[model samples]
Target: MADATPYEDSTTPSPTVLSQDITLNWKTKATVRLYRPAVIPPKKKLPLIIYLHGGDFVLYSASTVIYHNFCNDIAAAFPAIVISVEYRLAPENRLPAAYFDGLNAVLWAQNQSLGIGGQDPWLEYADFTKTYLLGSSAGANIAYHVALQLLDYDLRPVKIKGLLMNQAFFGGLTRTQSEKNLIEDAYVPLYVNDVLWSLALPTYMNRDHEYCNPISGGSYMGRVKGLPKVYIKGDYGDPLVDRSILLAQYLQSCKVPVYYRFNQGGYHGIELQNTSAAQQLYNDMTWFVNDVYQNLNSQDLSHHHASY
Candidate 1:
C-alpha cells in the first residue's frame, strides 16, 4: 500500500541554507521542502507547521505558483519551521497514495525535529507539542485524513494547535445544491471533478470511500470529538462549499470548536492570489492561531477540558 517513491519525475534538491529538502522513499518520492527561519539558535523551540499544497490532487505541485507563495507567507508570518509535502498526483498514483504520503511526511516532520543541528530537524527546532497541520483544496483532504490517522496511531502531539483547511474539499456521491450549481461552472465543472476522483482513486474505486471522501463515509462525524480544533474557509460560489459547511456542521455536532468562514466572491483558486480574498484568509488564520494559543495556555492542562 506504500510506494513512497511514486513521483519519479519530481525531485527535491537540498536546501542551500540551514534548511534541507529530501524525498521520503515511501509511497512516492514526495518533494519535501523544509523552510527554517533565517535566524540562528534562539532561546525557544519554535512551532512547526506541516503544510500540504493543493492542486485538485492531480494538477498542481509543491513548486506551483500559489502553493509556493503560500508556503513562504506562512513561514514569514509564523517565523517557524514549515514543511511542505509534494505527494504523488492522481491518475499516475491514486487515492490512498496521497494519503500515505501525507502521513509519512508528518511522521518524517516529527522525526526531523530532532536533527535540526545534527539530528533530524523535524524534532530539533520543532516543539512537537505545538505542531500545526494545514492545507488547502485537495491538500485539505489529505490533512484531514492524516489528522485522523495521527489520532488513530496514538501519535497525537502534546499540543495540536489547530487545522487550517482553506477551501477544503470534502464530499461524495451525493452532491449539494452548491455542488450541482458548479457542475457547469467555468471554474470547476462536474466533469473535472469526475476526472479528479478518477485520478485520486486507485485503479477503479469508490469515490465515497473513507480514504477519498471522509464525510460520505461517515468517518468524520465519528472521530471529530477529541480531534483538534479546525478552521474552515471557502467561497459561497465554490462547488465544494457545501462540503465545507456540512463538515463544519458535523464537527460542531461532535462538540468540536470550528472556525468557519465563507465569502461570496472569488473562484476556487482565487484565494491563492494576493487579493482581498487571500488577505481575508490570512487574517482569519492569524486570528485563529492566536485564539487557539490563548485559549490553550490560559488554563492548566489538568483542567483543560473544563474550559472547553
Candidate 2:
C-alpha cells in the first residue's frame, strides 16, 4: 500500500483533534480521534464520516503512526464528525472479523448520538441523512463489502449518504494497466495484492467469491445498484489505481452515480502523505461531502430508500 504522501511546500493550518473511544470485544479496546475547527460548530449535529484505516489490513490501526493524524486532519478540514475504526489485524483476527467490526461500528455510531463521551454533543452526533463511509487501501475494500452487507440486511441507515474510497482495493479477473505496468511498484505490487487476498479470503471462504470480488458477486452487485452515490479517488502510478478506475467503470456501466477523480502524480494513498496533494484531496472530499449532504436531506433519502 502506498500509505505515504509526497512532501510538498504549502501553508495550511494544523488540525484540532478530539477523542472517540469504544470497546468492541472484551479484550480489545480502541480509541479514535475526531478533528475539527477550534471554533464552535454552527449546528448541534453535522454529517458523519467513518473511516477504516489501511495497513494492508494487517499492520495498522487507530493507534498506528498515521491513522490518528489522518483522522484529525479530515475532521478539522471537513465540518463533519469523523469516526475511525481500529479493527483487529489479519494473520490474527483475519478477514471477516475486520469487516464485522466495521459494520458494527457504523451501526453503533448511528445509534450512539454522542461518541465515547456520550456528553460531548458535537463528537459523535450526526445528521443521519448524511452519514458517509470512507477508507483507503484495504480499508476501502472493507467499506465496499460492508456497504453491500448493509444493503442486503435492509439495514441501510436513513442517514447513510455515500462512500468515499481513496485508492480503493478492487481486483477483477482481467488485468488493469496499473497491475500490468506496475507489477513491481514499491508501494503495491501484484504479489502484495495476492498476499492481501490470501489474508482476507479466510473471512469470505472463497477468494474468488462475491464477498471477495464484489463486482462478480451477484448479491453485492444487486446491492450496489441500490447504494447511494459513490466517490472514488486514485492515481495512475499506483498498482491498485486501475482497480479503482475499473470499479468506477463498472459502477457507471451499471448506471450508478459515481464521482471519479484520478490524480496525475504520486502513487497509492498519496493523499494521506500529509502533503499538498493530500490537502487538495482533502478539500475535494469535503466539497463532495457538503454537496451530497446538502442534497441528501431526509426527504430525498426517504425517496431513495423507498425505491430500494
TM-scores for all candidates: the values are 0.81, 0.81
Model 1 residue 96 distance off true place after TM-score fit, in angstroms = 0.6
Q: Which ten residues in a row have the lowest lDDT in candidate 2?
A: 299-308
Model 1 weakest 10-residue run by lDDT = 299-308
lDDT of 1 at 134: 88
Separate clash counts for every candidate: 27, 5
Candidate 1 per-residue lDDT over residues 244-294, each given as its tens digit: 777776677677777766677667867766477776776677667666432
lDDT score for residue 176 of model 1: 75
lDDT for position 213 in model 1:
62
